[model samples]
Target chain A: NAGVTQTPKFRVLKTGQSMTLLCAQDMNHEYMYWYRQDPGMGLRLIHYSVGEGTTAKGEVPDGYNVSRLKKQNFLLGLESAAPSQTSVYFCASSPRGGVGQPQHFGDGTRLSIL
Target chain B: GESVGLHLPTLSVQEGDNSIINCAYSNSASDYFIWYKQESGKGPQFIIDIRSNMDKRQGQRVTVLLNKTVKHLSLQIAATQPGDSAVYFCAENGASGGSNYKLTFGKGTLLTVNP
Candidate 1:
């Protein structure tokens, strides 16, 4: 069904390199989010989008950026990759915003910074 | 800025045995709670959810119990199978101000099922 899809499943970059991770959902969801998971830690919110043209900062929004130009597509970018930024990035979507809604997640992208 | 956390980091169980994972949340204002299971190299999948007002909820072989008195949440699997091996996380969140949509998650507990 292609509920939520992420591209470039794995990537390795130098300390100062930059890259973009793409996420797309086919359920026509209105809310999308990006989170990073580290060892022995819970998933930390990086950035999120409420609609096609809206975005907001999350708990751990530092060192990352996100954009939602279309209803189904959400993009996460790293202006300058840091070693501390290496983690498993996950993207999720829901029918709408808020804590009451159920969120569906993509497989996730494994990013490594040298 | 409160958080949710698990008491145990890992739980090992034999096949056909029941599994119980516990979580504790620090926020009394949070009313919604959810459980997610994440396997290796994959995303977290929704297993079940419980609200603060409800004491228990069931789904398939899984059941979620919420104790508002102690701010504790637990997930019980009737008969955990090998497929049930994964990292389970409990998440809690609240909604207010017309736009605060945040879901705080716990550091997952890894469930190991022995065949």
Candidate 2:
């Protein structure tokens, strides 16, 4: 199985540019999440989706938006990228169970804004 | 603001030695904790997890101990090897709200095993 996969492994954007990151999972998980990993800052949640057609803002959702139109895919969009938004983005998924279940993660997408 | 944090930012061990990584959390209501290992250019991989009701849990070569009273968590690697070199993170769930799906992750501890 492919598990979780993220596209556009690396990208460079100018200030105010827009882009989208794609995450796909074959595990058929019921929950998906978007997180950004910054140096010495751990992973901060950007957005999440509990099920298809449902999305919720996470800890740091000011510059991002997410959509879970399909059960297997979650999309993260940066409407106007900023230098502060440059970070490695990770995607994760878990089974229907609550916090007890472990999450599976994708390699991640590295984005740099100048 | 309450957050999960690691006691040390880096650790180095000799081959065949035991390695211990420590974490501290301020949220008293956290009921579930997890340890993740991340290699260079990769995502965090689940190592093991323990619930607040339990004090300790063990996997193949790793053990996780949780001390809720002190708000402390630890991950112990039995045998340090080159493959064990990576950044280790601790995450907590059930911190706030009725949602149990959200987790607070620590900054991470880098473990290096030298031959």
Candidate 3:
């Protein structure tokens, strides 16, 4: 089973460009999250959803928007991509809405804004 | 004596040797802790976990130890192999009386096993 799937494994964009990152899960998890990873830094939470039709801001939420229209899908949108936002993006899902639960992650999407 | 944080951000060991990676958390209320390993260009994979009550938990070749007194966590790999080389992360599970729980991760330590 595809535990977690992230679309556009790799992408490139120019400054001010917009893009969307899609995360899908087949485990029927109740919680989903979006995080960014940079060199020498731990994965920082960007946005998350407790359940379908809900979204919440994370530690790093600026310049990012998220939507959870369906239980199986969570989308992260970048309205205006910047060079600083060109880090690897990861999508994760967990059985519960708590951090104590083990989260399954996608391979990750490599994005670069020049 | 208590350690304020991780002593080493990188570790190297000869193949077949035991390796230990350390992590320190800042929260006292965190009850759940997890260890994750990430290889090059991949997602972080769960290795093991321990709760506040438990001091240790083992999974296959990996073991996780949590010392709540110091808010410290550690991962021990026995008979380290080349495949064990990767970045290791420790996460604390916490909730601020909210429905959504979030994991806070520390700066990962890079482990290298040399033959």
lDDT of 1 by residue, B1-115 (tens): 1126433388999999999988888778887888999999999999988777789999999999988888888999998999999988888875445554678889888899999
- Writing each residue's lDDT as its tens digit, candidate 1 over A5-108 gives 99989999999999999999999999999999988788889998989999999989988989899999999999999999999999999888665687889999
Q: What is the C-alpha DockQ of each candidate? A: 0.62, 0.63, 0.61
| Cα lDDT for residue A91, candidate 2 | 99
How many clashes show up per model?
A: 0, 0, 0
Candidate 2: where are CA atoms >4 Å away? B1-8
Instruction: Give interface RMSD, every candidate, in order.
Output: 2.1, 2.1, 2.7
Q: Using lDDT as the measure, what is the rank order of every candidate, best first?
A: 2, 1, 3
lDDT digits (tens) for residues B2-75 of candidate 2: 23653338888999999999888988888889999999999999999998889999999999988888888899
Computed on alpha carbons, the lDDT of every model, listed in order, comes to 0.88, 0.90, 0.87
Assign candidate 1 its CAPRI class. Answer: medium
Candidate 1 Cα lDDT to native = 0.88
TM-score of chain B of each: 0.90, 0.92, 0.90
**Highest lDDT: which candidate?**
2
- Output the number of the DockQ-best candidate: 2
Instruction: Write the residue-wise lDDT of candidate 3 on B14-113 in tens digits.
Output: 9999999888888788778788899999999888878788998888998888887877888899999999999888887764566326888887888999
Give candidate 1 misplaced runs (Cα > 4 Å). Answer: B1-8
Which candidate would rank higher by DockQ, 1 or 3?
Answer: 1
